[model samples]
Target: MNHFLALTRRGAIALAFALTLPLPAVAATKIQHLISPGGIEAWFVQDSTVPLIAMEYAFGGGATQDPPDKPGVGNMVASTIDEGSGDLDSKAFHERLDRRAIELSFSITRDYFRGSLRMLKDNKDEAFDLLHMALTSSHLASSDVERIRSQIMSGLRRDTTNPNALASRKFLELEFANHAYSRPASGTLESVPTITVADMRDYISRVIAKDTLKIAVVGDVDPATLGQLLDKTFGSLPAKAKLTPTPDVVATAPPQRAFVPLDVPQTTITFGAPGVMRHDPKFMAAYIDNHILGGGGLSSRLYHEVREKRGLAYSMFEALLWMDHSSLVVGNTGTRADRAGESIDAIDKEVRKFAQEGPTQQELDEAKSYLKGSQMLQLDTSSKLATAMLQYQLDKLPIDYLERRSGIIDAVTLDDARQMAKRLWGQGLVTVVVGREPQAAAEAARAPGAPPPPKAN
Candidate 1:
């Protein structure tokens, strides 16, 4: 055990050093497309500078694949998939990973179930074998399932009182309404307890298949050897995923707002509007425009207006969200209960003005420069580079996208930014506030009869 701890320490030190070293330009990184003898495919970036390997992979069916009644089946599977597999129990399985300093984790978003692995080159064989077992033969024992389910329920219970979580949940529920996208990625307290081991196994059988797989690997591995590893690790998965066809959705354009009342000291606000899809011609333009509006940290217009000028909130931000089935421009901020209405009004005015007039020439130039320069940060480490590569694959971008990305950003002219801004954010926002009722709404409620204020959850 001491030797294992020492090796883990050494591995952490090596990773820290690797993170400090300068990374090659993404365009020059030379992503190699590889196909295994068994026809499994992966994107590989060979780097011998560090004696470590990082792998990131995703499958198409994410939380959306969960049965309508079982909203968190996919999330539960992600939690328990690595607990044990094959002949190993949870303790024995984790012991093997700890001995080798292998890092394995799984996560799921609305559209994809994702997993990552990091291990020293010398331990690659054991690492891949364990990963293979986890994916192909996860042992979702009843005890393990209940343990993870308890953990999930604990989180869900906490979220019930969490102002931010409540606001986000309310916003999605109001926006998506009847759509599965409205379901929380983490299963709710009620739904999580009812999920059985059989349900988890069924989720894996339907979702973890070769046809939906996207893999990206980085570090000291050659194409031929990586191909062999790919086949050995993933080739056994079902040839095709039995995914339910999810229809594309556009965010509700009719302005909608809802409030979930909690006794917190501050109100957390989440707002959203329709946004351009990833493949839209104006996406790049809208991306830059969003940065100027709220995506840029303290330099953003929203931050300047809300925090710097009026002191309504400590921080504010807006971002473009492109999901597999829908797209949205979402923003969030928190402020004192009494000032929540002021914060909302400030944000609305800024958004409307920006949509009509767009970013200034200086703002546009600065945004473009920052976007280009910050690209390197995303690839500075092996794990980060692998994750970025996986996203590129998921987006269906060309192999040479990094090389042409700057050119694409540069092509967005002032006119494009203005047009995209109006098109993306001009529709107005669907807002959700959680905490004390806003001052204006409270006053109106006290007056005549303002529909008796929406019931608090």
Candidate 2:
């Protein structure tokens, strides 16, 4: 077919639904589980809405899978995987996607290399074909390698002077110590240049295998066909992922004041303590306590104590960050250099208070209500729904997690919340401060930019 006719034919397949019309939302309470004929397992939610299909899958290797000498290899592969594949060269591959309105992309985090693909129902075949090529026979072209490497290098250079990047890196350094978590997810100034195309290929070969893969799918497909697509997209790979086993480690950031001196108008303070594991029975209680303490944004105790009551920092909040190796309750705030000591003192007082008393009954009730109501937003679209399903799989939660999520939250009694509060904040904080030396001894402690992509942490 001529180019225009090919485009016309491709577009015509979904034109009956006009390509832009949204199919009705599928009731998604029940997650359908299936094992492909090839024995590949995936979680599915059959939504024919909008003539669209979205698949999100992850391999257990990410930056952590990078060779010790090559910190950003996985990230570079994520950038180049679609640059060329099999018979299609870089430009040709992208053109096919654009012409058919298919979306396929990859990203790497600290723990997993993840990919997403979306397509009109009429184009699922081509979509899976392109994905298969990406997984199985990506060119990882030398020219593309240099191009992507330069981009990563540029970001690393900028991170050297970027205050937030500097602070985040330092925080991770303190938290993870010698673990892979201590390294930046993308690479450092010295690491990116040394990551060769061969290293990228080695990572791809060893990590993108069935034993380490997790998948979730939404929109316009049935199990049997999805099984075939899964086999086509992933079946040819080696069944076992040859990942270097990551060791178990805890964040070892000690309680004390530390600083990365930088000349800037305001100082940033970061603080954290050990966190409970996701699998721990007390996790839901702790999760709620975290929200009530600092994860609730302006509504949180940290916000009220530091920002509203004292006007110490423009922003302050904490979150429970979970990684394969370590868990932490990390928070950051920015304020005038002179106010740094006061801000730290304020935070310390609040932590002490919360550890002793936990959240008020009214606060717990409100937080639960908001969290329950917000679950709808999590499933508002096919892509997000697929991602949520993927997370459930990653977390090893049961397939009925969505149904049980509310009950889990509701089960956290006043005593549980109080116990969690005491448990989470009862330790000395590991604190890092930047922008200026913290003004006093009592103290301790502690993006956006058109500047560059964020350095991985």
C-alpha TM-score for every candidate: 0.92, 0.89
Model 2 lDDT tens row, 339-409: 77788889988998999988999999999998888886657777778877887787789998988889998
lDDT of 1 by residue, 268-306 (tens): 999978777788888899899989999999899999998
C-alpha-based local distance difference test score of model 2: 0.80
| Strongest candidate by TM-score | 1
Summed over model 2, clashes come to 5
- Among all candidates shown, the one with the greatest lDDT: 1
lDDT of model 1 at position 78? 88
C-alpha lDDT of all candidate models, in order: 0.83, 0.80
Output the worst ten-in-a-row residue range by lDDT, candidate 1: 1-10
